[model samples]
Target: MNTIPVRVVAAEVIAEGIRLLKLSSQDGSPLPTWEPGSHIDVHLDPGVIRQYSLCGSCTDTSTYEIAVKREPESRGGSKFVHESLGVGSQLSISAPRNHFTTSTEADHNLLVAGGIGITPIISMARQFHRQDRAFELLYFTRSETHTAFRDELASGPLNSSCRLLFGLERDAVEATLDDALRNRHDGSHLYLCGPQPFMDTVRAVAARHGWPDDAVHLEYFAAAAPLDAEPQTSFDVRLARSEKTFTIPADKTIVDVLREHGTDVETSCEQGVCGTCIVKVLEGCPDHRDYFLTAQEHAKGDCMAMCVSRSLTKLLVVDL
Candidate 1:
């Protein structure tokens, strides 16, 4: 990924535990254009890169906006951003990448967001509004105090099309989601981003209502649960170009082994949520442990996230 130097133009607390950051080129030039649902990787510190969804208006090329929530048990990224990053701070960021792009073909868009997941959904709502497309936004949060972009969602043009549900129990949230999906019109597409449990419940409700996989789009910031619990089997991996083979132990990752053999692979979010470490699979079956790939992609077995994924077959050959 290419990196660009940017300066923090503004920083403000939008809600409890959430901070909004606006970034721009160091030279005051226009930044790269990005579509809704796009995200950029923030290089917080050496070996600490984290992806943040762009929440600013796509029309505004002068700046990029992202909201960061301080995790209770942060592994450094969020904590640093919240406590250390301030206005005038210089930072490096990757070019914008879109894995959760909006579908322009859909006649209507139903956007659902939970907690900080509102970041991407807000951009989609703005894009849809600008294009005069039919859409509705449903935002769920713990309370009004915890909701980001409250002023914008309440007074902006999208206010009429938005619904705020706060302090709901799990069953209540599920019921609300069921009703939303149950009443969805034909040609309407669903987009969601949120905590794993919330997303799982929403997706489950959509599935129960017969929503096709293509009609539902989602982005995950973290894994639903621990991914290393299963008993791992030792495997062999061959580099197609290098013609080098390595024995991968059950406890080690493919990236670690490759690094040990003097091979370098660009990686971010080693937990497998980011797609930075994906590599092509020339010949063997991959276990498909990453949350970044779709089910169809996993079934194809053509690429794998080397950071946390492994081979399913005894010997896997990859296009190094």
Candidate 2:
């Protein structure tokens, strides 16, 4: 992944435990254009990188904006951004990459955002509003104070079509979702981002309502759960191009083994939420442990996230 140095032009707290950052190129050049749902890999420190969605205007090239929510149990990235990074701080970031892209073919778009997951959904809302497209936004939060971009959602163009569902009981939220799903317009597409539990609820509701797999899109704020829950066994990986074979221990990752063999693979979010470490699989089936790929993509068995994913077969061949 190619990276460019950027300076933090603005950094301020937007909501409880959330900070909004505005970044621009150091040379004062227009940054690369990115579509809604695109994210950049922020290099917080050596061996510390995190993926943040680009929440700013897609058409704007002056600066790229992202919202970072400090995780209490964070492994360091969010904590670093919230406490160490400030205006004028220099940072390096990878070019924008989109794993969760919006569908322009839908006649209507339904956006559901929970907690800090509002970042990407709000970007999509802005794009839809810009094109004068038919859409509605349902934002769920614990309270008004916890809602990020509250002012923007209320005063911005999306306000008219946005519904703020704050401090609602679980049953109430379910009812609201049920009603929305019941009244979903024809040719409408659903986009959702939130905590794993929230997303799972929305996905289950959508599936029960007969929404097709392709019609419903999802973005995870973090790994759903621990990726090492299942027992792992040793496996052999053969690099098709390099013609080098390496043994990946049950406790070690493919990326670690590859790097040990002098193969440096570009990787971010080593936990597998980011798609940065994806590589082609020339032969054998991958375990498909990453949250970045869709079910269809995983079923194809042609690509794998080398960071945390492993081979299901005894010997896997990859196109280094």
Candidate 3:
């Protein structure tokens, strides 16, 4: 991945287990401007790359701020940020990319965030405020001590349009969602970012309220759930440009086999959380395992995540 060098200008604990890092261009020049809901791949070590949503305003191109929650089951990324990295640490980060975004043309926007998922939702809320667009934000967390950006969200400007709820059980959350989504403004779009289960509940409530799939949006920071329990089987892959065919064994992934055979495919989170390895599928059905693609896209069967997803057909003719 192409990356730009940046130095951490500030580092501080934002929430109970979350740390905020402010990174500025190493050359003291303006950085790339990014939209809300955008994220960048930060290379922490030689082979440690993780994607984090840019949380602060896009209007300020001088620096990018992101919040990293120390995952108890972290593979490496969060651990490094919490233990090894600090102010003055230099790192390489990819240019911002936004797969999750909303149209400002909407008459109203309803934003829902869960725990660390607030990172992206807050950004969108800020952008909406700047655009003077009608919007409301619902932040759900365990308690006040575990929430990030509490002061900001509780103050003027955002506080008027945002509501923070803590210690709500699933039933209560559902009831609240029912109230919030029951009578939404016309042309209102719903944005969701959070734990999969929480988003699932919100989605269920929204669906019950008659929200269409097109009017609902979601951004996932982790894999939705464990991979399917179905038995694994080998499949065939054909490159459209080279007309080359290869068999992907049950034990191996398409990218693994392709790279072993000298086919270049870029990937970041090979676990299927990130969409870095998504590729076009010209033929065959893909057993989509990634949270990066929507269910509608999965039904379309036009692309597949080569890193972790597998094919459902004997042969998959794909764009290299």
Candidate 4:
């Protein structure tokens, strides 16, 4: 991935525990344009890279904006952004990549976001609004105190299309979901992002409402399921390009083994959520542990995330 050198032009708390950052190219040039649902990998320090959605305007090429919510249990990304990163801070970021993208082809879009998940959904909303497309945004937060972009979503033009539900109880939430998803439209699609449990609930409810799997989309900021669910085992991996073979122990991941042997493998969010370390598999069955790939992709058995996925075969061949 190509890295862009940027400087923070503005930084301030957008809501309780949420900090918004505006970044611009250091050379006074226009930043690359990105589609909605795109994210940039922010490099905080050596070996400390985290992905954040581009929540700012796509038409605005001068600056890119991202919102980071302080997560106490995060893998150090959110904490550092909230406490250490500020205006004038220089950082390196990867070109924007989109894994969760919105489509204008859909007759109507249902956008559901929980807390910080609003970052991507808000971008989609902006794009849809600009195009005069049909979209309804459902934003849920603790309360107004914790609601980022409250005034923007509350604008007269968007008031009729967006719903802000604050501190709703479980029953209320379920009822609202039922009412919102009761009827399925011909070309309607649902985009969801939020805490794992929250997304799971939304998916379950959508499934119960007869929404097709292809019509519902989501993105994960971290691993959804625990990788430890499977028992560890030792295996051997061979690189198809170099014809090099290495033995992987039960305690070490493929990435660890490869790097230890001086073979470098790029990785981020080693927990299998980012899909950054995904490589093509030449020949082998893999014990898939990543949420980045779809179920259909897992069934193909042509690739795996080296960071967390293991080989089901004793001898695995990979296209390194």
Q: Candidate 2: give the clashing pairs.
A: none
User: What tens-digit string does per-residue lDDT give for candidate 4 at 1-102?
Assistant: 569999999999999999999999999999998999988899998889999999999899999999999987877788889888888899999888887888
| Candidate 3: tens digits of C-alpha lDDT, residues 140-229 | 999998899999999858999999999899999999999999996669999999998999899999889888788898888877566645
lDDT of each: 0.91, 0.90, 0.91, 0.89
- The predictions' CA RMSDs to the true structure, in order, are 1.9, 1.8, 1.5, 2.1
Q: Candidate 2: TM-score?
A: 0.93
Residue pair clashes in candidate 4: none
> Model 1 reaches what TM-score against the true structure?
0.93
Each candidate structure's count of clashing pairs:
0, 0, 0, 0
Where is model 4 more than 4 Å wrong at Cα? none
Candidate 4 displacement at residue 34 in angstroms: 1.2
Quote the lDDT for 169 in model 3.
96
1-320: candidate 2 lDDT, tens digit per residue: 57889999999899989999999999998898999999998898998888999998889899999999999999998999999999999999989988788897999999999999999999999989989999999999999889999998988778999999898887888888988887666699999999888888888788789888888988886787888788899999999997999999999999999888889998867878878789999999999888878788899999999988888899899999
TM-scores for all candidates: the values are 0.93, 0.93, 0.95, 0.92
Per-residue lDDT for 174-241 in model 1, tens only?
99999999976678899999998999899899999988878899989987677776779889999999
Arrange candidates by lDDT, highest first: which order?
A: 1, 3, 2, 4
Residue 168 CA displacement from its true place in model 3, Å: 0.9
- Candidate 3, TM-score vs. the true structure? 0.95
